[model samples]
Target chain A: MAFISRGFHGRRPSAGTKLPPGQYETTGFPVLSAGPTPRIRQDDWKLSVTTEAGKQHVWDWAGLMALPAESPTVDLHCVTKWSKFGTEWQGVSLDVLLADVETAAEHVLVTSYGGYTTNIPLADLVDGKAWIAYGYGGSDLAPEHGGPARLLVPHLYLWKSAKWVREIELRPSDVPGFWESAGYHNYGDPWREQRYQGD
Target chain B: MARAAIPGRLGDRLRWRTAEVTGRRVESATAVTLTLDLPGWPGHLAGQHVDVRLTAEDGYSTQRSYSIASAPNGRSLDLTVQRTSGGEVSPYLVDELVPGDRLELRGPVGGWFVWRQQQTEPILLVAGGSGLVPLMCMVRAREAAGSRAPFRLLCAARTPSDLLYRSELRQGAPGLDTTYLYSREAPADSPRPPGRIAPEDLVRSGWPPDFEPTCYVCGPTAFVEKTAAYLVLLGHAPERVRTERFG
Candidate 1:
């Protein structure tokens, strides 16, 4: 994107410390979806991790709940330029979910219930960087916000989080999915303002 | 139609521009339509939206997205704002801003939700509240292009007073059919009772899914979700259903 003068941003001066350029802080959570929200029941929900080589690891709701989980306070930066700070989420870390799986893939393609998919570097999912969260703000994650388990990659733009996530596929090469193929940056980093292709 | 140029200049799609308010029209008690005159404004397609930014004198700025309510006029566009209680931007745009004031905006964003004049498929547009703004462009574009494509709109509002583009919609266009549902207060002598949009309403008022109409749904989150779900449940292909959301 060509540089454009943003004029004065003197108000909310303290927010500049945490917010990325071009983003504002929002207290009320906004719901943005391309289509309808899917109602996936916990009894029918399962998450799977697949390898490009064809190995698959699946976990049902009970199994996921039994695993040790953490509630972390994180900041979410949406590609649309809203940043919600200190949001809390509870879920199993990707490190824990992928600990048993061995793969040579360098990229991960996350899939969700509504057929939404987004790609991210495999490195971004490991080492405490991400989770498949089922709780938010001390309550069960609402379906409107990608409940029944959504991928929460707080480090990147919120689109990469992949709401209602159902599967994660490890691929040998990077592959763009959904928004990535539809003009969004293949790998979104809020701080760098990598929002679209060739940004 | 050259795909309406996908709404903006490269590298400037997200860049903010100063749009001078040229005119205003009160659409309803709670809504006002603002005409913006932009320099070298890249034309936008029906169903696309722009991000309107408001900066207070103290440099406190915020922005929200609103659909373009005007057809492709090349030099200017119209954005209709509905005042939301306690909303920072909507109230200012709907009640306070004057014709000479300048507003910052960026868009014609989202290429996917647009309606191209050349498309010949039957269209089923379902709108809730102010969601009618974007779909109205499609209706206007159909008339502007002089295309006779079969088009229908189902608009749901709290009451007749809550409807936007009241006169224009009432003075129908060729091939345009509409059904108005009042959830809170039905007009006297109205045939339909006051109620929310239901599955039966979709089957009764919309093009049958077998007709393969491209469905465009826009509204508040709940309304869009429920309406689109009903469309799919009625057998419209998921891929054929397009939606835009606002709250």
Candidate 2:
């Protein structure tokens, strides 16, 4: 049995508030990164989607802007146990980005500017689920918050939404990325509270 | 690659263990340092964190991540927690918890943010408020290991009274240089005006970027974002500087 501290009662959530197990609601968007924030100029930034067969679909800043954009208000859950609700973001859906690309892969390895990477399932990236978020709160996304562009997978742990994201490599098999290979769960589903490997 | 450097049982599956609160020390008005006794505890590197889980009588449970504040010792470690206003876990840990209390925690969580004794290059540590907790572990670890690596700490706090580890930091150790920047208030004899850390402060108090020193910055999100930006603008390579931001 887990030990319960004496006279300890956590704050009770409101009647309608929805959060993953072990998560507490937070209004602030905390930044967690392994390295310093990369200052990527909008002109120099590019997003690439490469399939297992080696076909590449690359989008420059202007090209990405030309694509139809969606404004999404979603909740974000970090594996560290903070959940921010109803956060607004602006970006193109992954569905739009992958509409023309052909792939039979089931997994994706998201790579960022500073050597950070996280793996996700290809199914989670389509069907209006994920986005390559470039703006937040009606303004250009700040670099500290994965500015220029970052994958926004709100359904999973925020880490799955790799910050400073640059490439999405579709893979036929699951390959753990930086945190995954280290200790974080390979499939970071917040709802399941699958934080660590054994969990 | 960061995991490869972690020593001992930490490389294995991390399991939740019972941590008994052996002692506690008041750090500031809103912060307290907890000394924990964990049986079968594996050693941890400086700057790693632990996930503290607390369950209620009704089986409702929540967890929070806290950085380890003490140097690695057998079967024991310390965590300095700052009470966030309206927070669920911190208030309990800081105000209500006492000696002999037991909690569940799984730990030594981070790899990239750690400081190992083998690192010999000149080190720069920039801390904002409670962010000093992990960096203090590095300082203590350096002292414990008798390492001669040059260490420079630039800590920003609201005032001298808000500073944690004030007395110990005053009792300086060898090969370590300490600089304090007060964002709101400073003592009468302070060298600089009260303000946020600027690029010049990095040049004066931190190792020059050319020194290729490994830099660690930790703090609240805004503080870290600004300080890290200044470090990079001052010429530190993006890869050489590591950061950990707290909510």
Candidate 3:
């Protein structure tokens, strides 16, 4: 049970603007990171997808750019209780990237350049549900906002879209990543208001 | 990779505790510091933050995160709120909330961006705008512990008037060096011209990269990005520099 503060009437979003429970709309994009931003030159960047059977598929910056890209304008919901709608991003769909990869894994541990990691179900990454995004708006994604490329999973909380994403390890069992181990929900679903472990 | 120093169940830390506003102080033109008294508050590190929730009579509610401003002090804590134009919760926190008002807040969040008293290494705190709040807590913590850790603070603000904890910073403590960089306006006796924090400003104010100081950078996204990038360029290890950025 929650208690109401005296005379603390908060801002109620205008009707018809859809937002998840316990979230408010924000015009500006906020940056949340565990540590300093990693500076990876485009030439030195590489992304690898390791399967449960130890099969590895690697893609250099050039290889990533060679793949077809899609422009996705999706809504973002952050566990921090801020939401942004219709954010434009350009990236290669996970379906296209994983089309040739063979995997029978149930989960994936997404890793980034700065040692940041997040876990997600493999089912959530396929079927045009996610992308490896490198561009935001029109230009290259800023380093502060995970430049070069980031995993774009709009269906879940923004943290599910790992920034500066570099590797994906498919595993048989679910293992909590950085934030997940630090008290965030392992399988973050913004619509369900699953921001923490119990919720 | 700093984990939560407080030992307890995650549920307890995330639990919403009722706190009454015991004291209030106007920090700046648009910022105010409220002292909240939580009856069963768990202690938190210097750089941790709290999530504040406000509910209306009609069941509408919203929440915002604010950094802890005061050093660990039993059940009492300080949160400095800056009023952003058209902001939902900040306006109420800065302009409307008063003493004796009760608010629900779940505390001491974010283990990564925290400063523990056990750390005796030199600390470099780079703050912009209201980012000074958490760093100020670290400074106060150092003083409270009587730890002689060398602390250098490089604060960038639009003007001196925009700086929080102005008088407290001016008082100055031993082993703590603070450099003020004003972007818009500078005082008459100010040494440097008014401008944004440049790489050279950090080089002069911050410890040499060779010293291996733990750097804490907090502020707006742009400020934190630029400052952190400059620090890395100056040869500081990326792992040594921790950041907490706000929109």
Clashing pairs in 1: none
Tens digits of per-residue lDDT, candidate 2, B1-247, equal: 1322324443366788998999999999999999999999888889989999888888888889999999989999999999999889999999988998887899778767878889999999999999999999999999998999999999899999999999999999988999999999999999999999888999999988899999999998888888888888888887788888898
Q: What TM-score does candidate 2 reach?
A: 0.95
lDDT per residue as tens, model 1, B180-235: 98999999998899999999999888988888998889888889888988988888
Question: Candidate 2 docking category?
Answer: medium
Task: Tell me which of candidates 1 and 3 scores higher on lDDT.
Answer: 3
Model 1, A66-141: lDDT tens digits are: 9999998999988776788889999999999999998999999888887878899999999999999999988999
Please write out the lDDT profile of model 3 over residues A1-199, one tens digit for every residue. Answer: 5588677777877667888887999888998886778878999999999999999999999999999999999999998889998899999999998999988789999999988888999999999899999999999998878998999999999989999999999999998888787677778898887877777
Question: In model 1, where do residues sit more than 4 Å from their true spots?
Answer: A1-27, A137-139, A192-199, B1-13
lDDT score of residue B66 within candidate 1: 84
True contacts kept of each: 0.17, 0.53, 0.60
Please state how well chain A of candidate 1 matches the true chain A, as a TM-score: 0.94
lDDT of each: 0.84, 0.89, 0.89
In model 1 chain A, where is the ten-residue run with the lowest total lDDT? A1-10
**Best-fitting candidate, measured by DockQ?**
3
